[model samples]
Target chain A: MRFINVIKVALRALRRSAMRSILTALGIIIGVAAVIAMVSIGNGAKSQVEASIASLGQNIISVYPGSATTGGMHGGWGSASSLTVDEALTIRREISGIVAVSPEMRDRQQVLANGLNWNSSVNGEDVTYLDIRLWTIAEGEMFTEGDVNSAAKVCVIGQTVVAKLFPDGDPVGRSLRIRNLPFKIVGVLKAKGFNYFGSDQDDVVIIPYTSHLKRIARRPNLNSIIIQAESPDQMTRIQQDVTDFLQQRRNGRDPDFTVRNQQELAEAATATTKTMTVLLGAIAGVSLIVGGIGIMNIMLVSVTERTREIGIRLAVGAHGRDVLTQFLVEAIILSVMGGTLGILLGVGSSQLISRLNGWPVLVSTSAIVGAVAFSAAIGVFFGFYPARKAAQLDPIEALRYE
Target chain B: MSHVVQLEDIHKTYESGEVPVLAVRGVTLTITGGEFVAIMGASGSGKSTLMNLLGCLDRPTRGRYLLGGTDVSNLDRNELADLRNQKLGFIFQGFNLLSRTTALENVELPMLYGRRHFSTREIRERARQSLDIVGLSNRADHFPSQLSGGQQQRVAIARALINEPQILLADEPTGNLDSKTSVEIMGVFQKLNAQGITIVMVTHELDIAHYCKRNLIMRDGRLVSDTPVVDRLVATEQMQRIVTAETDAKLIA
Candidate 1:
């Protein structure tokens, strides 16, 4: 009953100064709105990065040729041609839980078709390369293993290569020249826009590794090997097996290859976005603190302004504790109302920004719940001092206050 | 009649900077139930201090005060507030009614602070009844600014009486009103007093003091005289005489 009375008193007092109350609540509104909107944008960017990484294919591990040493000089990763097609085939036969493998050998070459020439990365890969990388064939059929064994001059062209070399129609079955050597286009790959590194993924062509090794570049070494594990849980075990097998293949000598999994690359990629999210969130949180301080300032002024009213209530037998509760309840009401409004504003604005800027915005449920709960805590924390100050005033002096 | 207030050598002193100012010194008094008494003095005569001590708004510096048989000197702030709520009703010279609030809500204020919970219906019913007793039943919804000075004072009185306090303490209840409104407020008091309500009023007006049965004059922090009024004025009769005199003089307008 006493609680209800104080609530009634608080409500009446708030309504008495409706404009001041609304202005005070506006501080919290902007603070919470900033928090929610900023977090949504941050989360949206994060998920977008994650989705692009996921498109790299699930549960994949890539092995690259490690750095090479000669006396005092050291050549970095990818500088050493330290792997071969024979070693890749040996791993495929020896490793268990392996789904698919693509031994890759890449070279940049100027390709000419119908009197137009363009420089593009020409990769030599196996028949299972598309499946391992989760790339789909858009037109025609993949070159068979028989074509790989024979070092056939047949290839699959990427969307960028098709756009550049064959703008008229489908280039499937058409022939394009690489280094004055003609290679027939067997299939066309679906377009993938770009990776996180800002490099075009669709500007490429693929041919059998045997063809590149035996005919085009005449190199015995493979650039890298891409392997797909059956599932995410087996990635670690499969990675360990591959490393140990490669090391053993080196006859107990130092291995000349570096292994990396998809998750590690994804984590490294998302770290920057995570930092940005926290930075934006912290800046938004500072505004919330300032909002809390605003509440405290207004409550203190309210206590001083209503001194005589406090005296009247005290004289009428209201306890000092009752005054404290009434003021605290008023602060909480202001902040909670602001918080609710902030949530609506935040969600609406995020949607508007997403539409206007064409940016990905994912509003996380946890962030919404956390922001409100934090604002409520801010109410309680900032309201205590002013309320206590009001409660400790002498009724006689309060009555005498102007 | 049983004693409603008992003060024993109550002294109240204040430290005004370096000098210790004694507001009230060695004042002892007793008032029985159903008595309408007035405390009168000039400025700095300590009558307000004595009233403060009596109303339990401030404790005596060096003595004890028993209000309705309870020792109030040793009570804490909350205890005194509860005691004031339950046992005493206070009226101020300024008619300290909350502005913008309806008279009914002002009357209901005391009940809202009371310990025992009253249902909404009961609180509204009792507040309306209190307003009716003060003859402002129809003005229950009127704000303080909307009402006349006398009406506002009456609303304060109604608020004071809502809790059924054993004693009503009025600090210059008629101080802000003109002679006619003063007597009219006096008439309201006389009616409530006639119904056996104990009232303690502090006033400087001799005629206002004359309305009470007993008068205690204070000077220089001490009680100079305590005497019963030889010719007590009845508020109802005084208001009637004023009305008749006005009609005879043609000053009704």
Candidate 2:
């Protein structure tokens, strides 16, 4: 028999029980939808984490002060003043792959501005700090190198600090008094949403490290130093060089710094969401298997119900392979059609959930293609036995069957 | 005249369960082209088994059965199916039309499975022609459930003829029909037979047996008698007489 004719026969048989065919296909529909929805939700969360991590900085390496030893006694990482601002400048001038350097020193204090006072974190940094952190200035401009060299009492305020200290309007070109020292607010930092740790990124006041060291904090040691790598390929080499040079500068003393790169931070941040995605995908896979079994069960029932019909075809000269092909094609058509509809429903529903629940959802083309292909494979896997049974039946016995 | 079917000492045994039951015992038969013959017997007399063997639905245990001058007894499953498609047509007593299918599609079924290819338009045209030959062209679009028993049987006949088989096999074709409908079915067979198509029918009814030109009677898994009918029954005359009697009875009422 011609292949086209076989398809027509299979189609006619399916249409014979249209309601049953659709109901049988519903199992597959739900299975595919669950897979798509769960995977997209997981991807959405992962993307959100990645975006937050990107907000931290691009190609950044951070150096934190390590433990200090005092003759059989030890102080943990941030316990002693271990790093100096002069060393940060020395490293930036020496490293070839280094693009920018920001020596960080954080201290929280009450700041008064425009007849209002708010306690906020004060950070001392370089002019290149905004570029390395991928942050944009919302108003005015950052403090220049001349400001850092002269110890000018100029500062940049973050969005949260602006909202708190200057509620009426822009904080740029204004005055804020830090620890009784009135500093000019030169710029307003753009707002960045919450980080993966659930802490706000836009609640800081930034000043030149020279100003914080000479006028406010009255200290010479620094808290941390942030470095930007010129290219991804050279980040590790630069990080190694900075760590060795800093340790060498100690000259056999207890190491007082730990260096970490951006990739490590991103990996740590995304670990939880990746686990969540795998768990959701596994649960959805179980439903898809159940759907396949449902298809097998319905196909078996159909074969049993159509024994006499099969017998008639056999008697009229249909080959056993023809019968097998017809029934197998029927199952594949059911699953493929169900999978197509499921993709539409899954994409639409995921977008709707994202919109209504205010959650991120990313529907990928590969996921859509994989779901359809998986459903078709399920069809073939589940459809083989019943089709074989129908094909191998004795024609005489089948004809005699009521 | 060329022999359309030649069976030599054919044997069929049913080893289905623990015990073996002999269904056909060394039956020899020959049917020439254009001949109308009927085999009559009681239930369990192996007439159905013989019909199945002749139709290539089952392989005989021993001996050769030649259909259209080709030996088909030892042929494999697919080969036998091909032979059935190329050389034989079958009509069952149950009028086993696929449910929910239109009569036109039922008629097109044989051509769908045949070795020769037919275009969609050609298949449709041929199905229409087959239905037209069976005088069911107007009812082509109607499903089997909507058709009467006689109409459904006619549809089956149309299906059988579509492949233009060398032999037509009928196993109690009129067993499920009332007398008038039976006569109508017989009329169709006789008309086809007159057009030089070979026909073999198995029926328990003696009256239906007489409609054939020759008769063979089986008993105890063996053929007991084979003879030409001296006074054959004509379906057209019987149909006419029935109509005249119905009209006369209505006049009396």
Instruction: Kindly list the per-residue Cα lDDT of model 1 for residues B72-99, writing each as its tens digit.
Output: 8899999999988889999999888887
lDDT of each: 0.87, 0.87
Q: Over 4 Å off in model 2, which ranges?
A: A58-77, A90-100, A115-117, A164-171, A179-182, A194-200, A227-269, B237-253
What C-alpha lDDT does candidate 1 achieve relative to the native structure?
0.87
**Model 1, residue A46: displacement in angstroms?**
3.5
Q: Each candidate's fnat, in order?
A: 0.66, 0.73
**TM-score winner:** 2
TM-score of 1: 0.82
Error of 1 at A250 (Å): 8.3
Tens digit of lDDT per residue, candidate 2, span A1-402?
Answer: 889999999999889878768966776787788778878887888888788788888789998888777897888887668889878999999988999999988889898988889888898998899999999988998999999999999999999988888789877788999999999999888888676678778888999988988887898989899999988789999999998889899999878788889878787878977998889789878877787677667756666557778888998999999988887888888878898888888888889877887778899777777767777676666566655766687787786664
Docking class of 1: medium
The TM-scores, chain A only, for the candidates as listed are 0.80, 0.88
